[model samples]
Target chain A: ELKVEQNPLFLSMQEGKNYTIYCNYSTTSDRLYWYRQDPGKSLESLFVLLSNGAVKQEGRLMASLDTKARLSTLHITAAVHDLSATYFCAVAYTGTASKLTFGTGTRLQVTL
Target chain B: DTAVSQTPKYLVTQMGNDKSIKCEQNLGHDTMYWYKQDSKKFLKIMFSYNNKELIINETVPNRFSPKSPDKAHLNLHINSLELGDSAVYFCASSPNQGTEAFFGQGTRLTVV
Candidate 1:
């Protein structure tokens, strides 16, 4: 069974602060994804890290993958109030499969 | 337009009743999946279909059946619904296996 774990399941940071959420998986995966979800809305894709050392950034968020270490990270730069949401790291099944094993999620609460 | 959409955003029903949630993606993806989010907010894969062929079937109960009529459509039908079945169900699709997936807004299933 592949297990995906996220550290600091709950995080509260003030606006303009920086923090990183870690995602560690138990097995090798072909790809990893970062997603964000509001309290009552659907998940929105943030980044897709497809290879080792792959890093992607969008606005105040950056995601990187270290496949060799079976880990991924989502870093927030200068967090803002709108960044308050649940962030999830999902690992894709190996080979040509679309199934995903998701982490426990990190609920971020950015305040002033 | 919604890339992936699931009908009946909210469903409330009595136990033992049968219900189905519909999902359709207009993104022309070849693979679709069904995921369940429990109260604790842990997301788990339930079923996956690639080009209308059953590809991944998680250890979900037999009462939950997933049907895919086409590459762009997948539906989950639950019979003899139990209280444990209450959760937020999401439908997702990807252009191919091991790729970024677009998710639906999710259907909140509530069993009374």
Candidate 2:
């Protein structure tokens, strides 16, 4: 059984603040993904981390993976109101076709 | 154009009724998946198809059956629906296993 855990299941941050969401998995995986979802909407892909020390940044969000530690992080730099949503991290083990085990999402609410 | 799309963005039905949700991807991806997001926002994998073959089948109820007529389409049919089946069902696709997945807008199912 692959277990995925996320910290701070709910977060409320002020605009322009910085925060990091952590994702930890119980087993080694070939890839990890970060996704964002708004209320009543499906998930949108944020980043794909394929290797250790891989980091990707888009706009105010940056995601990094540390495969050795079986951990991944999604960092928000200078959060804005539009960044309010639910974030999820999923892991795909080797030899699987999108059989991802997702973490309990972290709901983020950024206010002015 | 939508890369991935699901029909019936919202569905409200009575228990014991049978219903089906349709999904199609235009990205030319070889793999497709169905995920369930529960009330607590826990996303879990239900089924996956690769090149029209059932690749991964999670421990979902037998009433929930997935059909893939072609490489680009996957449909989910649920019989004898229960209250617990009320959740957002998402359809996603990727070029291959362990790749970044593109998701559809999701179908919100409500059983009363």
Candidate 3:
């Protein structure tokens, strides 16, 4: 079974600070994804890291993948109140179908 | 227009009752998935269907069944709902295996 673990399950950071949420998986997988979910809302895709060393950044969030280590990371640069949400990292395994195993989410609360 | 959508954004039912959650994707994707997010915010994949074919079924109980009537629709039916089943259910789709997935607004099911 593929297991994904994330660190700092709940984070409370002040605005303008920087933090990183780590996602580590148990098995080998090349595709990794980062998603953000606001309170009472659906998840929104943040990044799709398809290869080792692949990194994607949008707005104030950046995500990177390291397939060999079975790890992925979502880094928040200069956090803002709007960035407060629960972030999840998912690992994909391709067999007869593509299955995504999501990590324990990191709930971030950015305050002034 | 919403790329992926799920009906009944919130459902409240008594234990042992049966309920169904419907999902549809207009992105012309070939793969659809059902995921459950527990109150603790852990997300796990429950089922995966590719081109209307069942591909991935996790260790979910037999009481839960997924039906894919077509390539664009995948619905989940849960029989004898229990309190443990109370959580947010999300539907998602991807163009194909190992690709970026788009998620729908989750259906929050509360088994009272």
What DockQ values do the models have?
A: 0.81, 0.76, 0.77
Which window of 10 residues has the lowest lDDT sum in candidate 2 chain A? A92-101
Model 2 misplaced regions, further than 4 Å? A96-98
Q: Candidate 1 lDDT, tens digit per residue, B1-112?
A: 9899999999999999999999999999999999999998999989989999998889899999999988989999999999999999999999987688889999999999
Please report how far candidate 3 places residue B19 from its true position, in Å: 1.4
What TM-score against the true fold does each predicted structure earn? 0.97, 0.96, 0.96
lDDT of 1 at A37: 93
Q: Which candidate ranks first by TM-score, i.e. highest?
A: 1
Distance from true position, residue A46, model 2, in Å? 0.9
Candidate 3's C-alpha runs over 4 A off are: none
User: Candidate 1 residues A18-93, lDDT tens each?
Assistant: 9999999999785999999999899999998888999999999999999889999999999999999999999987
Model 3: per-residue Cα lDDT over A1-112, one tens digit each? 7788999899999999999999999887889999889999988988889889998989888899988888888889899999999998888876556688888899999999
| Isolated chain A TM-score, each model | 0.96, 0.96, 0.96
What fraction of the reference structure's interface contacts does model 1 contain?
0.85
Better of 2 and 3 by lDDT: 2
The most accurate candidate by DockQ is: 1
Give me candidate 3's TM-score against the actual structure: 0.96
Q: List model 3 lDDT by residue over B18-102, tens digit each.
A: 9999999999999999999888888888998999998888889999999999999999999999999999999999998757889
lDDT of 2 by residue, B1-112 (tens): 9999999899999999999999999999999999998889999889989999999889899999999999999999999999989999999999986578889999999999
